[model samples]
Target chain A: MPTDKFQRWVNDLQKAQPVHPDQTKQTILSAMHPKRRKWPWIVSAIAVAMIIFGVSAATLPPVQEVLAKVPVIGKLFQSAELTIVANAGKLQGVNRTQSDNGVTIKLKSAYVQGRTIGVRGVVSGIDDHATTSGRNIVYHLASKSNHLHMNKASWNLQKDHAYTFELVGNVDHLASGRKIQVPLVFTKMFGKKINLRFNLELKAGKPVKVAFKGQTSVSGYRIKVLSAENFDGGIGSLRLRVTKPVNERDYLFGISNIHINGSQKDYGLGALGKHKSTKQSGIYEFQTVALPKKISSLTFNAEVADWSKPEIYALSELPNQLKVPNRAAMYQFQPASLHDNQLEFNFTLSGTTSSDRVLQNDDLPYLMYLQLADTKREHAIVDEYDTKGIGKNRIAPILYWVESSHHFMARVDLSETPFKDKTLDELELVVPSAFEKTRKLPTITIHNQK
Target chain B: MDDIILAMHGDLPALEHLLLENADYLERTAYLYLSNDTDVQDAISDTVLQAIRGIKKLQKPQFFKTWLTKILIRQCYRRYSKRRHDPILIEELPVVPVAGNELSSEQRLDLLAGLRQLNDANRQALLMHYFNGLSILEIAQITKLSPNTIKSQLLRGKQQLRDWLGDDYFAN
Candidate 1:
């Protein structure tokens, strides 16, 4: 542990230094001026106005373009994500509270044109009496400005999603019985698009976690099963959940949209990934009766609402690999005959588009090849009836099978316990087009159909 | 206010006592950062003057050394930036007579050669730890880095120092 090379190195540095014994105490003060002082505190008083009023430094004269040219310093500043401090006008004697320190820090944009603004932080120090202006709140309109780059170049919805923040911290001075207040106004750089459910983890500090199940709208909307004839559009709700990423923070909830189409419905804040409403990957469309409002926010263009199209198919994507059982638990489904006295709805990759459809397309196969990976089981293209409407034939239920390039068919099966199994984490489904002779195609779900 | 004025003018005995205790350390700190120059004294003197003027602003006086040293370090960086040099190498230049005292041989030979090779960040970390004697936590607060980052730098700096000083020279 005691290497002499290290010790000598430490020694050499100590030896090569000098001492300044004479220059110990110094008394220095800046030139006093009245107008020079009133600018900073005044801005802090109007921080809320500044942020909501949109008076930020957006107008800075092409900051990134001009700053990109300054040799070394320009490169540094340009490449940097700037988080410079702006002056928040003054707040004098506002009946200070313990948790209000971060809020008290005055904030403002650097300039009206958006560059070179000032930020002044006001901490009330004891034995410190500011020059008596006519008003008790002697606002520091101008602040000492410092430069920072924009939010990090890589910061975005994926990695770091930054949002505006208001922080307030106050703790009492134990010795003097005076309170120490720190009112900081700064933008927080969150790595993700403020996903309260996924990113806001409960670790140590207080963080707000929010999740919602429906869109946070003034009006509460509900999803109703409409008659197939009257089916109009999808309803949406924004669901959100908030968990403490830090310890002891409060939970929050917000809505995104309500009862959107299964595919159009965006996921809540609890889970991570590209869970947005606009994503069109896995939505199953159904008929919805029109509600009172005709904003058409609910109407999507690609929806197959013609009702006359005969090739009814439930479409979903299959991942490259299927997850097998790690450790099997509980009992298997005792082999039961699929249908009995009740009408059995067949699950198929290809099927007649409507119940009234008399002729099926010969170009497309009437059934699709279905396979189970865990048990090398293969079912032939057949007509299976589906009696359970709640049953999403995502894995085993063959909603519709493509028998050929154009012909469609449906499968009829009696058993329906696959989705109800508590042990299954994921199930796989494949629908191969008959004419392709190779590629298994995908199907889109048509809801509330016979 | 008058006492503050007295302290500022260096008329107060308290100033002298503080000098006797810490002037040597901060001077060496200034020389290390400012790099054995004439202005090193002035910069250190300014650091002291600034600290004295703002001592009331210091909530934790026990950490006065690190606190004042932080101010000195900032001044050093600012001055160095003003001079437009990135990692200023002081020993390559002719020596300027330090105003107060010379460095100890143990300090001079081992630390100077080792410290010159360090980048601004590592050298600052090393000096703040051994010279100004700041803890890892305090160092983190000043450097705005996590504790582990500081520890790794210290380890790397110490290793580099050993490699340069030759075997058995600094054996402890």
Candidate 2:
């Protein structure tokens, strides 16, 4: 049959030899069953022996001291890269185990400071083929009242198909020396159900509240450190408010170089939480590392994009498509249509660099702050926009690569910003400068903390 | 079918057996999207890893091939998107083995080149429908497009291929 010939051609196409045919399966198996490290097993053995002999280990202060010094659960904290928790002085050893379906989960240690709670554990007896992404495994830690607010959790695969896990969160109404029953549940592990609960005796300490009233102005932007709370194990939360120019088009792109204790070293800020922003100012909360017991100093820099000197081009004057030069790639913007208070553009990026370099260097989307402004220079309120599946939002543009067409696609929507009822002829598309000016603000130091 | 069940129950040997059974199909399907042999191998390895990890989540064991094919396609697209800028080397093209077939080696090369020229959607639709022998509904389910859309794409893709290959090519 005619179709049979085409099928033969496709079959012939599939006869290509794989580059690493001999080692492909073995490589995959090796990844699934990584080589076991010797130290963790030794640590596990020593800790297990202590647990077997020291029945009243918690009651005995000396035994508890030894357990604290070499806790098996400490391995979980170390595996998670939470050095603060691993080196913490107040870690309490739980050393409890639950087993089902040949799988054993051991809760090793926990700590409570203020409302913050940290628990570390290990899961063993996973099949070698059960090599799923760590993201698929879900761990839920809750109390009977369900007031335990989980902040962060991580699980790392260990040798012998085992996994070390860590959980950090905040709990409400946790008093010092109060005993709480914390139930840790693994809803599904390798398609099996496993539930483990532990009765934890909480020895909570209060997190010191540091009054951070520092403000600095740089490049027409005011950055203020509102407040901060210092928790045990060098974990802290810093709240900041950045006030931008009243112009809606002007944007405070980013704030970085956050350092404390007058040290030049950057401690690296973690996830941002509780963000409230408006046209004028934005309040941000950040989880930081190595917050000192005493507040000495705090410093940071703010980057602001000043749109006062934007290059204005009329909608009629601009071409249908134009190539803009970029560092790692060339950006092509094809203006599709401008009708009914909506303007559309197809943005494509093409480059001859590695994917990582292209992804890191492609900043046209951030600099492509196209806005529709009237002759009076009043900008329109951006009502809604859709980049299809390309760009994420107006501020943060996440460009998705189109597999068929070797370029990234972004569709911009500017309908309701300055004027909802203005014609295309009466408005001009404003293009902001591609570069943001960074300014270092004066360091603010705190004094007289109890 | 027993293998699927055992694999779902965290049996490593069973999972390995299942992957080996479908290895050819996975590699071939990935080759349709990626040109590089190394990329195709990476995609296959990723498919196997993901299949082993997520086999238990497969509600219907009968759809194992379909599930594995979907994972392979995703991995192929990921590599394709990442390495799109790399120049395609002519030497890297697969050497076609001559067999007792109607189409000449030159004609086969033309067909492969024509297939590559089609857009991603049309090419995927044509390959899945004709090469993989997937029904329109199955293609729609896998591609997350409507059945009607898949049908149109298949029709358009076949027409485009016919136009490129010419009437004499298909008449053989």
TM-score of each: 0.25, 0.35
DockQ of 1: 0.08
The best candidate by TM-score is: 2
Write the residue-wise lDDT of candidate 2 on A328-442 in tens digits: 4454556445667555445554553442221332223333443344344432211122211111122222233343344543333344344445555554544443342223344
Looking at candidate 2, what is the lDDT of residue A307?
35
**TM-score of chain A as modeled in candidate 1:** 0.14
Cα lDDT tens digits, model 1, A1-450, are 334544445545545544323332221111012233345324422432353234234322111110100011111112110121111221222322221322222232111111111121232211112112111111111101111211112101111211122211111100011111222122111111110111100011111111111211111212211111110111111111112122321111122222324445422211111111111111111212122221222222221111111222222233322221221111111111223412113321222233211122111112222223343333222222122211223232322222233211233332444433222122233442222221111221222221
Question: What is the DockQ for all candidates, taken in turn?
Answer: 0.08, 0.04
True-structure lDDT of candidate 1: 0.30
Clashes of each: 152, 7
**lDDT per residue (tens digit) for residues B65-111 in model 1:** 65667878766755654553332221122221111112355335434
Worst 10 residues of 2 chain A by lDDT: A62-71
Q: Give candidate 1's total backbone clashes.
A: 152
User: For candidate 2, what is the DockQ?
Assistant: 0.04
